[model samples]
Target: MRSMLLRARRLLGALLLAALLAPAGAMAGPCGPYTTGNIPDCEPQQQAPVPYGILETQGWAYYCTGDHPYFWGLSSSYPGDFTWDNSCFSAIENVFPETTPNKFDATFTNWCLSAENIVVTLGCSSQPPPGFGPSCNETGGPVGDPGCPQSNISNHCSSTNPPVCFQTATETCSDGTTYSCTADQGIVWCYKCG
Candidate 1:
């Protein structure tokens, strides 16, 4: 009886091993269409292209006390690689001295290609306000104020956009063999006439 039990156990182990290994060979078939020469001619799958063009804006706020106008100096986190264009896209006065005495607040916008850290400096000079010297303050960083509006690039190549139409052409190679090619806005593919 013990010998019979050992034989049965060995048979079950062999059956399980065979079952596991059998599917591996069955799965090894041609994954795509083949040409007349039995060569695989798998068409490359297309992927969603990344949008390289980007337009974004950085926000800033400042407060100055004096009768003189204040000017802003902007700098980027990446100095030479990425820098502000030295011009503010937009500016608005949030607080005025008429409403609040000796206190003022204004917001400014600067444009950048990608997301970057922006630093703003305020400089002011006053002539009439003798006792009250020009005092300037800056408040901004990589990420600007939470209450301010931020800008971003819109996706123009998404599925919602129109499909790209490809142009087909035929060209002869150096050996005088003609090949068919297709090109879209930025990509071109050529295949031999087999």
Candidate 2:
């Protein structure tokens, strides 16, 4: 009888230790209420288009001060759902997605987290996201462009999207100008290094 009792005690202790040492993701469920200074227990994750546009993106405590950091813009075209964690203080609303779609995300499908009158964006990984690249170069012209005229957006070596993510603005133009100190809007060919 004493031996049996001792064995049971040992088993219980081992089980408790195993539970404590298990991986964080093993239990499953949200580790949210994720806020500016709160790091939830779950692992950071970004998964999208799993079962067809089933977007899911979550991140723990990360200090961000810019609007862009909170603004999770879709990959130019893929859009879906209005989801937020508990910290956001907003409910999970579908917001009539099937009928209406808009260019600006704030209205219908922008993942915004708000706490204390502050709103931040958090985008989900899209349906497989985009592959390859999409670098934004000088959109030369399309015949009837509303005119993105010389609005201080000069021909500078820009840190554009994919295709040419990082740029080295070292071009000795025909007019004798090197680096990003040029002051003209002439046409020059941009070689893409992927």
Error of 1 at 44 (Å): 60
* Candidate 2 lDDT, 104-184, residue by residue in tens: 123222233321322333332211112311232322221221222222232222132321111113233344422221121
Choose the strongest candidate by lDDT: 1
Report lDDT (CA) for all predictions: 0.30, 0.27
At residue 171, give the lDDT of candidate 1. 48
- Candidate that would win on TM-score: 2
Tell how far residue 64 is off in model 2, in angstroms.
12
> In candidate 2, how many Å is residue 15 off?
2.7
Off by over 4 Å in 2: 23-30, 33-37, 40-46, 49-194
